[model samples]
Target: MRSVASRFAPYQELAEHLLQATISEPMDAAHDVGHLLRVWGNAERLMAEEGGDRSVLTAATLLHDCVHVPKDSPLRLSASSMAAEKAGRVLDSLNWTAGDVEKVRHAIEAHSFSAGIVPTTLEAKILQDADRLDAIGHIGIARCFHVSGQMNRPICDLFDPGADRRALDDRAFAMDHFQTKLLTLTGSFQTATGRRLARVRHDKVRDFLNGLLEEVLPDAMTVSH
Candidate 1:
């Protein structure tokens, strides 16, 4: 309902900068502009319902992936960090305050599951949950498989034999994303509203995983979507 500019001019300016920078990247699957917008949309809804700060949430959403590279690629991760620094500079150019920029930048950097950056603020948690939510359900499945293709990782039933159960490895981020970020998001949400949404969305992915696992046993490939 209410637009961003009428609320906080500084954050809205930073968000616009983030938009231009992220859109310039060579993103295809998980990090695309459409996907980022979806996460921000979800964050907006949850933040409004939960009474969190909308401007900060929006800033986190836009900047979170401005430098996000694939989890397994160390080179990309380094590149991502450099890009994040550049994003900070971009924000600085907009005259955003040091405190607000630090807050936004920390949330952006900590939003990654593999990075092990835990959320300490409601804005951070909202951003984390929104990003995590995108990694599940129908869209999430497609993104996961798409990511697997990018990583050249083998496809495996996430519920069993092929899914690596090890903890927090970036190479396993594609399919195992369900476990690392998606599933964990169920509890990590800062607000009750987020937990509710996360639980429902989380169930969709879990059910999807179970159905896929059942099909993987044998003679089930003929089942249609």
Candidate 2:
């Protein structure tokens, strides 16, 4: 099927600009705009398979994380509102129509799992799926550690939810994320395509965690890293 990615003129044009802005920043191995684009690409594929309102879903998927501050950053807990605020200003500047802009805002605002905004539209759900899908595999693994490192979270934080959540310390947020959010996304995805892909990506996360525990455990043999 032809990609629905190119149908929305303003989003496409603005996404290019956002891509430029993100790429201009010197970054390494984590939640970058380049990765956001890939997430959007995957979202689009799922959208095509799931068959939803392409325009809104495409726009939402592309912009969902356009304003994220960082990996495992507190934004994972607190940024959706901020991202919504920023996205609103951006849509207004682009002269997007009121209705389309509202849809965009709704999708962005509702995309966060932590934000707990229940999705009211198919577009919102797809964007949520796409964003989470990006958080699951190798790219997901790399980004997770990178986020934890930035937060100064310990390697053991992966299994400790409460400590990570209460940490208030950005350093401990990554583990909180893995325990409370990242691993649970597959179960929460709203679409068939999203659910299926999430299952596969989630397995990668599951295996990684199990392998880590086995390797690191004193009785299991030896840890690789």
Candidate 3:
């Protein structure tokens, strides 16, 4: 199996151009270039297992968050749409074919959880799976806290670490995100490879949450008196 970078070597120039643009754009730590690359890498792995239009998947992954909105902004739900519009312009500048550009745009538009757009094409599904994959595992944990810190959200609610008693408010507590989104992603993947990988990553998150509950919940941590 070819490495992600090597498999996508043909589009490295375009990828680099996109990377340069992403670096110059103002984005939160959770949605930066590193996050983009991770998503692209995930796309590459998924694409290998599930064949799709590599050009569309690669371009979509690179430009997915180009027009990022703040997590708490009213425009948050529309961020993917905004990115799709910006990506179309960028792809036009790169002289990509109309059909190909449209495919890329649709993939970007449908990749976001908030957008709630069902992906029709295989490339779009791959892009969606790839982006969501990056929101789990250790990196996902880091990103959750990073975004939490940016939004002034706490790491966990001391009394309700799992958000069992109250409505899950990820914007107020990072751990609540697991119950709200991350834990639910494994069942939402669009590809077999994505589902396979998601299950592993999901287990990691579950373990972390269980450990956290043990440490934070008084009953869970009780010792014989």
Candidate 4:
């Protein structure tokens, strides 16, 4: 696997500068360097076919999560906009053109699912897809539990793990997130490549959810009886 610096190619210096400056701050396990690299990797795959400005995509992908609000924070919905604002400042320091800065800002701001901003540019669409791609499949499985642990959210509701009898609240149960978001993400892909890759990863998530249901549901039923 390529290092995050190597992934940026001719723009590696820019990536390195931000990594040392902005990215050096403390972050949760889910939003750390590994996540950045994975998102960039996903972006590269999408760019290979979707076609977007590499320099802008590189900067946006690197700084997309520069601001990390806790998942439960009231500020969570604005996290992407805040990150975009910070990215604009960082790029201004590096002397990027105002137009280019705005492009990066839009990509970063629209990339968040919670932010609910529709991506208008190809780069923004690609960034959004790439970031979301990291939220499904096997890696996504690990990330999900990692975050749940961090927030002390339970893996499921135990007696009603599937929430068949209760309201769905991902905040209270990690498994509920599958129903609320992760499982439905494939349909939300912005590009053809992203959608194609998403279908494959979506299956992995479904299979994992199925396997978990098989193991846990019966046990819960047994305990309830």
By TM-score, the better pick of 1 and 4 is 4
Q: Please provide the root mean square deviation of candidate 1 (C-alpha atoms, Å).
A: 5.3
Return the number of clashes found in candidate 2: 1
* Residue-by-residue lDDT tens digits, candidate 2, 139-205: 7877887767766677663443334234523345553455455676788888899889888888777
Q: Provide the overall lDDT of each model, using Cα atoms, as 2-decimal numbers.
A: 0.65, 0.66, 0.83, 0.88
Residue pairs with backbone overlap in model 4: none
Candidate 3, residues 152-182: lDDT per residue as tens digits?
Answer: 8888888877666678788788888877888
Query: How well does model 4 score by local distance difference test?
Result: 0.88
What digit string (tens of lDDT, one per residue) describes model 4 on residues 1-225?
236687789888888887764565668878889899899999999999999999999999988988878989999999999999999999999999999999999999999999889999999999999999999999988899999999899999978998877998999999888878888888888999999999999888888887787788764321110
Error of 4 at 33 (Å): 0.4
Which 10 consecutive positions of candidate 3 have the poorest summed lDDT? Answer: 216-225
Q: What pairs collide in candidate 1? A: none
TM-score of each: 0.77, 0.75, 0.91, 0.94
Model 3 clash pairs are none
Model 2 lDDT, full chain set: 0.66
- Clashes (backbone N, CA, C under 3 Å), per candidate, total 0, 1, 0, 0
In the predicted model 2, the residue pairs found to clash are 151-171
* Residue 166 lDDT (model 2): 46
Query: Regarding lDDT, does 3 or 4 come out ahead?
Result: 4
Give per-residue lDDT, candidate 2, residue 8: 43
Provide the global lDDT of candidate 1 against the true structure: 0.65
